[model samples]
Target: MKHLTETEIADWVTGLHTPAILRHVEDCPECRERARTLASALQLFRESAREWADNRTPPVRMIPARRPKPWAVRWAVPAVALALLVSVPVYDSYRRDRQARAETALAARQAAEEAEDAALLSQVDTGVSRAVPAPLEPLVSLVSWNSGSWNASAGQ
Candidate 1:
């Protein structure tokens, strides 16, 4: 008798074979053992598939939430405002002190210049008040001679 092919055995194991191949498998011990092994492996695979499908869970995705600012950052605006409010008057006072010093320096320089001018004018007045001696008076007159005095001196 011809033995059953592996395809016939597989088909018989899955209940897809004709009655003739099934009869051959029933009579053939070797083919019966192969069919029995294939059936048992297929049953095991179906049980594993059912367990996996029933117990599987879908993946979860997490989204991040927005957090509030820290305490220091929240108070930074008021701190800066307080600093500006405290600094404005101090800066104004510093500017006014600087301007006063400059004006005092300028007034002192003007007073010194006026004192020097007054001293020079006093020296000029003293020089103009002093007179030459009598012997030098004739020499002074000759130096002041005009054209008439020049002609008279030429005749002499």
Candidate 2:
């Protein structure tokens, strides 16, 4: 009978026995020794492989980079809108104030003009009327008044 191969011997040691190769290894001393040596080598290789697996570090998982949310842009829109809303009322108030000031100035100017007209009328009526003489004739002459005075003095 032919002796078992190393593959057959290894398989037999691991509980995968073939009957014909088993019969060969049972009768052949050289085949039996080869099977024993292969079994020992397989055991040593498995132990070292386990040790190497235990000592090895796992690969690190890299996290993907993330971008932050644009809160500034979100807030900026609301802030601008609020500013416009607040300014609208303030601008309206300022416009109203300006209009009121203009009306007040116009009223003051009209009042001043009316007062000046009243003062001119008063000056014309009082000063000009009082300065002009009314139409009248003189009662006595200088020569007649002097002759009467001389006669009275002579009689006295």
Candidate 3:
């Protein structure tokens, strides 16, 4: 087969040719090398084009035209108002419940402290009503007094 022309080679590189071009490149070393060079040049051109496009800044900025607002935007305010109406009462009830629990705990603690204080005062009264301390009560039974004098033996 005759060697492929530059256009034929280009078309083949771009996937535009038939099986004959593939056979020629396979059979002829010179045409095969030419096709490979063209393919490499095309790949370089594509990379440079991408890089140039990325580096280029747009000269004129176009503002996108806005479409009509959706139905949700119209009800946005009512939705927020409903959320607040639902949340405010729930928050208030939560705060009131916490306050009631704290008050109950405080009352119970005060009652316990008062009971402890009352028990302590009753112990003090028992200690003060004793004529003699309990440790010396046995000595009292061995001694007696009569006729304004000390007596060692009274019933013996």
Highest TM-score: give the candidate number.
3
TM-score of each: 0.40, 0.39, 0.47
**98-132: candidate 3 lDDT, tens digit per residue:** 99999999999999999999999999998899878
Candidate closer to the true structure by lDDT (higher is better), 2 or 3: 3
When 2 and 3 are scored with TM-score, the better candidate is 3
Model 3: residues with Cα > 4 Å off, grouped in runs:
1-53, 56-69, 137-155
lDDT score of residue 125 within candidate 1:
82
Instruction: Give the per-residue lDDT of model 1 (tens digit) for 13-113.
Output: 76768899989888989888988998999989877876776676762333443444568767989999999999999999999999999999999999999
Writing each residue's lDDT as its tens digit, candidate 2 over 66-144 gives 4435697569889999999999999999999999999999999999999999999998787667623333213122123
Relative to the unseen true structure, what is the C-alpha lDDT of residue 36 in candidate 3, on a scale of 0 to 100? 92
lDDT of 3 at 116: 96
Model with the higher TM-score, candidate 1 or 2: 1
| Best-fitting candidate, scored by lDDT | 3
lDDT of 2: 0.74
